[model samples]
Target: MKKQVVISMLGTQLDQGFGSARWEHWRPTVALGMHEDFLLDRLDLLVDERRYAKLARGVSEDLAQVSPDTQVRRHDTYLPDPWDFEGVYATLHDFLRGYEFLPDEEDYYVHITTGTHVAQICWFLLTESRIFPGRLLQTSPPRKKDESVAGSYAIIDLDLSRYDRIAQRFQQQQLEDRNLLKSGIATRNAAFNRMIEQIEVVATRSKAPMLLMGPTGAGKSQLARRIFELKKLKHQLPGRFVEVNCATLRGDGAMSTLFGHTRGAYTGATSDRAGLLRSAHHGLLFLDEIGELGLDEQAMLLRALEEKRFLPVGGDKEVDSDFQLIAGTNRDLHDAVGAGRFREDLLARLNLWTYRLPGLAERREDIEPNLEFELERWSREQHQRVTFNREARRAFLDFATSTQARWNGNFRDLGASVMRMATLATAGRIQVDQVDDEIGRLQRQWRDVEPPSVLDDLLGGDVAQLDRFDRVQLEEVVRVCMRSTSLSQAGRELFAVSRQQRATTNDADRLRKYLARFGLDWEAMKAARTTSGNS
Candidate 1:
C-alpha cells in the first residue's frame, strides 16, 4: 500500500498588539474548525488538549448544520505541547512512530496549512531537524472571497538533480521583483534606453567596473539601479545591490564601514559588523561621488577590485567578496588624475564601461516630456490635479531656450519649479504668468554678471593724447588725436601753414574767408594766440 501523507492543520492568531484587530477577530473562528466548509477532507486538525475542548464545543455549537465528519477530533488525553521544536518533533514522532504515514525514503508529503510566520519557521526547523516527511507543501492565503481557502501549496521535491536549478530560479524571481521596484523611475528615452541596454549587457556580458559620469541630478544613481534591475531580471546575479556615498565614508569610519570590522576592532567597536562590501557579496556595489574617496580609501578600493579581497578596518583576517562595481560621479576623473588627486591605475580600471549622461540642456527634446512627468508627479504628491495652460507651456519653452542655464541641477530643478508653480496656482490650471514669474525669479537668482564692454575697453586704454570734443564726437576725435597729438600742430602740419599763405589782395576779410573755408576762423586763431605774454 502507498504510504499515507500527513496533512497538518496549524492555526495561530496573528499578533494584534500593534492594533490590527480586524485581521485578528476572524482568527479564533478559523482555528476552531468553525469554517470547515472551507477545508479539504484529508487534513488533520491538531490542537492543544485544553484548547481542543473549547474549540470542539464551539465548532459543534456553531457548525452543527455542517457535515458530521467535518468536526475535529476532541480527546481528553494529554499530548506534549508543540510550541517548541523539540517538543513538537517528539510529539509527531510518537504519533507517527510505527504508522504508514512515514515515507519509505520517499513518496509521503508533509503539508502545512497556515500563513503565519511562526508556522513557516517551525516548518523550516522541522525539515532541518530531519523530522519532516520526504516532501514539504505550503499554502498561501486566499486572495479573494470566492477563492478556496484550502490553500495554495508548493511541493519542495528537493531532488538532488534539480535542487540547484530550482533554487537559482527562485532567487532569480526574487531579484527580478527587487529590480522592478527599484527601477520604477527609469524611462524609455533613447539615452536612457541605450543606457539600460548597456547596463543589461554589462550585468550579463561583462565583469568590467562601470563608471556613470554626469552632473548632479542627471540620474546616475537611477541608471545604476536600472543596470541592477536588468541583471536581476535576467537572473545573472543573486546578490543584493548595496549603495554607498563615498562622501559619507570618511576618516576612521571609512574602514569600518566599507570592509567591516570584528568585535572590539576599535574602542567603540562593541560588536562585529559586516561592511558594505561583504553585505554586497555576490551583488552590485554602487558608489556615488566616488571621486570624493580619499587616497587611502582609493587604495583599499583598488585592492578590493584587484583581488576581490579586503581586510576589515580593525580585523586581521581578509574577507573575500566578489561584487560587480558601479560608480557615479559629477567630477571629471581624468582631470582629477591629471591634478594628482586620483590614481591613474584605478581610473584605468573604471574606464572600461564609462558613460557620460547628457545634461538637460543638451537634450532639449526631452525637456517637455520630463516637465509633464514631473508636473503630474508633483500634482499627485500635493493631492491636487493641475493642467498646464497652452501659454504656460509656451512660456516654459521660451524661458528654457532664452538662457544658457547649465541646468546642472537637472530634473530636480525642474521638479521643484513645477511644484512651486503648482503651489502658487492652487487652482486647476497653471497660468503662463506664474511660469514666467518663476523663470524670472530663477534667472535673477542664477544670473551671470555682464562682462566689460568695448567702451570700457577703450576708456581703459592710454589717455595721454586725449582730445576735447562733445561726448558723441569724442571717440572719433580721440582716434584723430591719437594719430596727431595737438589740434594746432595737426592743423598746421596737414593744412600747409599755421595762419595761411598771404593773399595778394590784402583785404583782411578775404583772408578770413579763406581761413573759414578750411574750417578755421580768425577769432579761433586769436583765441589760439591766448596773448603773446602767456605764450
Candidate 2:
C-alpha cells in the first residue's frame, strides 16, 4: 500500500531549531520524527521561499536518522503575513487545487503543528468544509523524561454533527429564528406556520425578487414590510423601504412618477424629480397592486426589474436603481396576460419565488388572536385599553368565523370591526349587548354589498334560465332592494348610471318592470329580505 502523505506549513522560527544539534534543542520536526514514528509516509513542507534552501537541507539531514526511507519535499510557498487569514488560506487553497491525489492510493494528513494561529483556524475551516480532504494532525511538545522520540500527536477527523453541544445550539437558534420571523404569533395554523418558516429562510439567505399574490386586505403588504424589517435587522439591507400603490398611479403621471422625468418632460415640468424607483436604490421596492400598472408602464417596469436601468419619460439617458423588489397583486395576472392587459414576460420574471397568502376567511382560526392584537393597537392609538366581556368575545368570534360572515375585505374589515367595538366601549369595556349590535351592523353591511350567493333560493328554478350577465345585474337589483327600506331608494341608487344618459329617468318604473320579468315584485323582495334576515 502507498504511504500516508502529510501536508504542513513550515514553522518560521522552528526551522532553525529543527534537529539542530548545534543549538542543543530538539527539532519539532525531528520530535515529530518521520513515517514510522508518526505513521506519515511523506512530508510536503510548505516553506517561505526565502529560507527554502536552509529549511530543505535541515529537514533532509534530520530525516536521515528518523526515517531514511521517508521522502521529504519542500515547496516554496509565499505568505507575506502568516497571521493574515486570507494570505494563508489563499496560498493553501491554490496549492491544494494544483494537486490531484487518489484517496484510495494514499491517506492524507494536514499537520497543524507548525502554522500561525490564524493559519491553524483557516486549515480547520478548509478541511472541515472538505476543501482540503484530510485529517488534521496536531503535535505537542515531548515530556521531560521522554528523550527517545519527538512529541505526542493526535489525529482529528472532523464530523461536525458528532459535536452534540454545537448541533443542539444550532437547532435552538433555528427555532428562535423561526419564532422571530413569525413575530412571536403562536398560531395554530399549520400551513401558515410552515410558509412563515420557509419565508424566514428565504429572507435570511437570498436577495431575490419575491411575488406576494393574494386577495385584497390579505396581509401581503404587511408580510412584505416584515420581510424588509427582518433583513434590515440582519444587516442584509442598508437602504430604506419604498412603497408605491400602483392602483393610485395613472397616465403620464404614472410614468413620470415611477421612472423620473427630465426637465420640460410634461406640462407640470418645474424641476426634474427622482422617481420611486430611484428612491428605492439599494433598498426594497414594494409595488402593491402591481397588476394595476398600465401596459406601457409594465414594459418599462419590466426593463427596470431585469436590467436595473430605465429611461426617464423624456430623457435620452438610462438611469440605474439597484433595488430588491417585493411585488403584491390581488389580480389574476395570468388572466390579464391572456386578455392582453399584462405582459407574459413580465409575469414570468416576477413569478419566481411566488408565495400565496391565504385570505382571512381561509384562516378563521387566527381571527381571535388578531382581534386581541387589533384591540391593543386601538388602545395605543386612542389612549384607551379596551377588553370584551367573556360572553361577548365568544359571541363576536362565533359570528366572525361563521360561514355566513363574508369577510370580503379580509383583515381590513376585521380591523374596522375591532375599531368600532373598541371606540364604542363604555368605560373601556365591550358588553354582550355591544357585540350583538356590532354583529347585526356588520351583517347588514355585508349583506348589502355581498355577492349573490343564494341566487337559486331567491329566484328558485328560474335562476338557471337567465344568462350570466343578466343574473349578475338581477342579483345586484335584488340585493339593493333587500337593503333599501323603500323601493324608490333602491331605484335611485341602482339606476344612477342610466340617469346620466337621459334627462328624465324613471328608475322606480324600470326597476319594477325588471323585477316583474324575474316573477319578483316589490312585496316579494321585502318578503325575501325578511326571510334572509331571519335565516
Candidate 3:
C-alpha cells in the first residue's frame, strides 16, 4: 500500500490547552486523534515564524503523543501577514521551489483548512498551475446537532471546466475565435468551416512551423494574414508580420534579401543590411511558394529554423531571431522531395500542421456569397454602392455554376468578374446587359487558351485540307457535342440562328450529317478525346 502524506499550515492557536478536551476538538485538530481518525505516514507543516514562534514547539510535542508513528517535519516559513496575498504567495512559492515529492512511494494531499482565505487562494493557484501537484483537502469542525463524530471534509479539484458555466464560456470563446479566422465572411462549405475551426485551435496553442497547401488564389495568403491578425490581437506576437513570395525572388540577391548581408559580403553589398527574417523577429514569417526556393537557400533556411540563428550572406558572425514560420506552397512537397528538389528534413519540420484549402472549383457552393463579398469590396474601394439587378444576378450565377465555366483562376476569376461588372454598372446597378458583356469577354479569353486540334488524330490527313476557320469550328463542334447530353441540344447551339428560322428543324439529323462530313461519329469522337486527354 502507498503511504499517505499530508502537507498543511501549522495550527498554532488550536494546539494550546483551552478546556479539558476542547483543544482536542479543534478543527484540522492535528494534535488529537491524528493516528486514529486521520492516519498518515508523514505530516509536512508550514510554520509561520512570528505567528507560531511561542506555540510551535508545544504544537509538535502534543502531536507526537497521539500520532507517535506519523513522522512530522516542520519547515520554518515566515510571512508578514497570513491574510496578505503577496506575502503568503511569496512564502509558499519559495517553499515549493525546494520542496520535493516522492510520488512513487506516497500519495500526497494539501490541507487547506487552517490557512486564511488569501493563503487558500494562493494554494489553489499553485495547484491549478501544476506547481503543487496535489489535491486540496478542506476540513471543518463538528456540527452542534451531530457532535457524535469529527467534522466533515471534502476534496476539491481546480479543473474549472468540470463545471457547466466555465465550459459554456470556453465554447463562446471558440465561436469568437472562429469568427476571427473567417474575417467575418459567412460561408457554408462544410470542409472550409471545419478547417477554420482547426486553425483557430492550432493558432492559439502552438508556435511550431505550419504549412498551408493549396492551388493558386485559393486564399492561402489571406488565411496567413488572418492568423497573424488573430495572434497579434491575443498579444502573442510583438513584431510585425513579414511576408515574401519566393517565386518572385530570383538569383543570389534572393539570399541577401531573406538572410541579410554584411558590408563587403558581395560586390553589390556596400553596407550591412537586415533582411526579412530579422524583420520577423518575435513575429510571423510567411514564405509563399516556398518550393520555388533554391537548394542553397533551402539548406540555410533549415539551419535557421533548427538553431534559431544563422550566418547571413557574406557574414562570418551568426545572428539570432526567434520567429514563427508559416510556409505556403501549391506544389506537392512529397513529390518534390522524391525528385530530389526539396530537402526531406525541411519538409518534415513544416509538415507538422498542413491544411489543404480547396480551390473555388471545389467550393462552387460558396460562389454566391463570395460574389456578394466582391461587390461589397468594390463598394468600399470606389466609395460608391453597386447592386446586381435580379435578372443579372441570376444570369451571372447560372453561368458561374455551369459546366462550360471552368474557374481555372479560382477566386481570382470570380473577383475580377465582379469588379468588371461593378465598374461597368450604370448608376451603381449592374444590369443584365453588363453581365452578358462580361460573360462574352470571359468566353473569348477562355477560348484563346484552348489547345491545338485533336482533330488531326481523329480525322486523319483530311484534317490538313481544312483552313483555320473550319478547323476552329470543327473543334468547337466536337467539344460541345461530347459535353452535351443529347444530339438535339448540341445541334440547337451549333445551328442556333438557322435552326430557329426553319419551320421543321431536323437538329439531330443536321448534326449527324455534319459529323459524317468529317468521317467521324459522336461516340468515336468522344472516345478519342478521352484518350487524348489521358495521354
lDDT of 1: 0.64
Number of backbone collisions per candidate: 0, 2, 0
lDDT of 1 at 533: 26
On the 0 to 100 scale, the lDDT of residue 518 in model 3 is 75
Q: Which 10 consecutive positions of candidate 2 have the poorest summed lDDT?
A: 18-27
Candidate 3, 153-210: lDDT as tens digits: 7777776767889889989988887887876778789999999999998998999999
- Give candidates' CA RMSD values in order: 25.8, 12.4, 13.9
Q: Candidate 3, 422: how far from true, in Å? A: 1.3
Off by over 4 Å in 1: 1-197, 448-535
TM-score-wise, the better of 2 and 3 is: 2
Instruction: Itemize residue pairs with steric clashes in candidate 3.
Output: none
Q: Quick one: how many clashes does candidate 2 have?
A: 2
Candidate 1: worst-modelled 10 consecutive residues by lDDT: 15-24
lDDT string for model 2 (232-273, tens) is 888888888999999999878999989899899888888898
Using alpha carbons, what is the TM-score of model 1? 0.49
